[model samples]
Target: MKSFAFVLSILAVMGLAFWAYGENYKTQRALSEVESLQGQIGQLRETRAVLRAEWAYLNRPDRLADLVGMNFASLGLVPLAAVQFGRVEQISYPRPDALPSELQLGPITGAVTVSAPANAPVPAEDMLIP
Candidate 1:
């Protein structure tokens, strides 16, 4: 009976060792994947920085102006002047309309209530702004 118990304990230890070894390998693989992903992220960030620099260089106003001037005959390009800009007051704005009020949860009222001004326009199923 003692011999049987010893054999059982040995088998248990072996099983534990096998499980631990498998888990260790899995952990190592996951760590390696994480490292690889981190490296890719770093490379992507570097690439993004390089692309941003290139974009900035390519979009320089002087460079763009030169290109436009070279192609002006075909492009019908016009030079911008201060007079081309408009004042904010020139913009036509939409009239103020009643927007849906926020819902309040309290012990006094369990139901939801939408409050709007009496002069508010009838709520449309679909609001279109054009």
Candidate 2:
């Protein structure tokens, strides 16, 4: 009976040892995967930095101007002048179509604050001339 109990205990210990060995390998694999991902992230970050530097180099105004000059006949590019600008009031905003007659505005219940008196004189700074 004692020998049987001892054999059972030994088997239990062996089973546990095998389970722990499998777990250790799984942990090692997970660590390797994490390291590989970190290496890829570092490579991507380096590539992004190099690309940003290249973009800045290519977007230099002088280089762009030279390129534009070379393609001017085909591009028909023109310089901007102050006369090209327009006043905000000159913009023709598109109005949304009216809802079907069946739909109407809901009741307004929120508190509305009037910032300035209706009779107050207009401020020069608030006016837009152009």
Number of the predicted model whose lDDT against the real structure is largest: 2
Tens digits of per-residue lDDT for model 1, 52-79: 9999999999999999999999998877
lDDT of 2 by residue, 39-88 (tens): 99999999999999999999998898888899999998866789999999
C-alpha root-mean-square deviation, each candidate? 11.3, 12.4
Model 1 clashing-pair count: 0
Q: lDDT score of model 1? A: 0.80
lDDT of each: 0.80, 0.82
What are the models' TM-scores? 0.66, 0.63
Candidate 1: TM-score?
0.66
Using alpha carbons, what is the TM-score of model 2?
0.63
